[model samples]
Target: MKKLTMALIALPILAIGTTTIAGMKYASDDDRCERGERYSQEDRQKRNPDKMVERLAKKLELSQTQKNEVKQLFINKQQQRETMREQMQSLHKTLRGLDPSAADYASALAQAKQKAAFMAESKIDERMHMKAAMQKILSPEQMAQFEAMQSKRKHHQGMER
Candidate 1:
């Protein structure tokens, strides 16, 4: 009787846990994307330039001048990305007005691709600028250290997979 009662209790607990997991799996993708946990602009600013410079300075053992220059570079890149995001959002809004089955769909898709290409170009430009700025700020030895750190991070990420 005790074994049967214990099994009855365990069965409901397992069923409840499985149901919770299944419900999460079936939840709306849009609802997940637009959830209340989204970061605000203020949160983004707090996370950028200033926080990045502090972290990089510790990792690279940067001088005051190098830290200042790196921070400025990060700020400029962040602003450029924000502008690109706005342009992309506008293009997406325009694309949304066209019917998916219309002949204009091809033209709309082409414009969307152009916008995506522009954003990608801007990202590459930002990365190049960052590399150049880092090169100017860091010594050869420091650059080696940075590369090693990046490699370790990549390896750790791969292990997680």
Candidate 2:
């Protein structure tokens, strides 16, 4: 009787454990965020530069000329970003191949740091250019709305954390 009771208890426990694991596996594909902030794949894709400009254009009621100029600005920035990504990838691969404890590792690390700093500076410059373009294209009212939207986005990101 004791053996049968133990088997009965074990069966339910095993079932529960399996159900939990299955739920986790299903949730991960839908919810996993490497940065720990949740966003769906399509939502993230819509935030890409072109889509973001389209979204902003709709919000601000941009003229056709303004939209074209904004699109070109973002395209330029995207090209710069792609170039930086390639350089960073090369630097990372080089760093990965070097032995940490080796005598040459210090020089390799220094080179990687320099590349990273340069890339960071370039990114900042691109952002400044984008901001300047936005200011030139958007009216005061539109700019104010844009700033508010940015603040709201920042607040939400903070809340998610």
Candidate 3:
């Protein structure tokens, strides 16, 4: 009976100890980055265009036509980003496969880096295009509010890093 009572008490302590250790294991930046990447991939798979439209409509008080346009814009931008992401992944894979001991390795790595930069630039350009499209869709006050929201998002992202 004494052993049973001690075991019962120990069970909760053991559980809490394991939970604390598990939480601490994920406290590093590397763990957070891996988790963030996994979460983003899952989120992309689960994200609904209609739900995004509804949320944006509520936030921006968008008209029906504006909502439709914004939905299309979001779809196009996501497609572009996916294409760019694929290209970047391919470049990274190529970089990983190249022999570091080879004479051409430096050139190959540089070329891969250049392609990655180009892909990144394309994504930024696409974002600028989206911003321009939104400018046409949103009222001046709405655009200002949108810019403020973007700034806040960027600030938060910077803090996260």
Candidate 4:
């Protein structure tokens, strides 16, 4: 009887735990748009630069000219980002290829770290420049709204898009 009772208790507990976990997974996709908090997707289609610009244009109520300008800007930035990604990937592969027993491993690793630090600085500078460029393109009212939206995204995503 005790064994049966324990099994019964365990079954419901397991079911509830699974249900809670499943709910959490779906919850992550829910956007609190009213609060200016968006749950960005990692999907390749959603991350496409042109699609992102379209979303931005709709949200900011951008004129056709402004939308074209922002689209061009995003395209340029995306190209630059791809280059940086390739460089970072090379650095990552180099680090992965190093053998711990190699005498030069430490020095080689240090140099990679130095390169990574410079890349990080470059990324920050590029982000600032992009923000400035966007602000220049936007009207004052649109810029304020854009800033608010960006600030919220930064709060959620560690200042990354």
The top-ranked prediction according to lDDT is 4
Q: All candidates' TM-scores?
A: 0.71, 0.70, 0.73, 0.69
Residue 161 of model 2, lDDT score:
40
Show model 3 residue runs off by greater than 4 Å.
1-42, 159-161
Candidate 2 residue-wise lDDT, 1-161, digit = tens: 99999999999999999999877764755555544655555754554777867898999888888888888877777667668877877978887898998998888888888888888888898778878888998888988998888888989889534
TM-score of model 2 relative to the true fold? 0.70
As a whole number from 0 to 100, the lDDT of residue 54 in candidate 4 is: 81
> Which of 1 and 3 is ahead in TM-score?
3
Once fitted onto the true fold, the runs of candidate 1 whose alpha carbons sit more than 4 angstroms away are 1-9, 17-37, 158-161
Sort by lDDT, best first: 4, 3, 1, 2
Per-residue C-alpha lDDT of model 1 across residues 69-98, encoded as one tens digit per residue:
888888888887788878877877877776
lDDT of 3 by residue, 1-161 (tens): 99999999999999999999988977875563555455467567567778888987898888999899888988887787778777877987898899999999999989988888888788788878889999999999889988887788888889534
The TM-score that candidate 3 achieves is 0.73
CA shift at 129, candidate 4, in angstroms?
Answer: 1.2
lDDT of 4 by residue, 1-161 (tens): 99999999999999999999976754754544435554443532356777887888889999988988998888889778778988987999998998889999899989989999999999999999998999889999999999889889888988665
Computed on alpha carbons, the lDDT of every model, listed in order, comes to 0.81, 0.80, 0.83, 0.84
* Stretches of candidate 2 exceeding 4 Å from the true structure: 1-50, 159-161
Per-residue error for 75 in candidate 1, Å, reads: 1.2
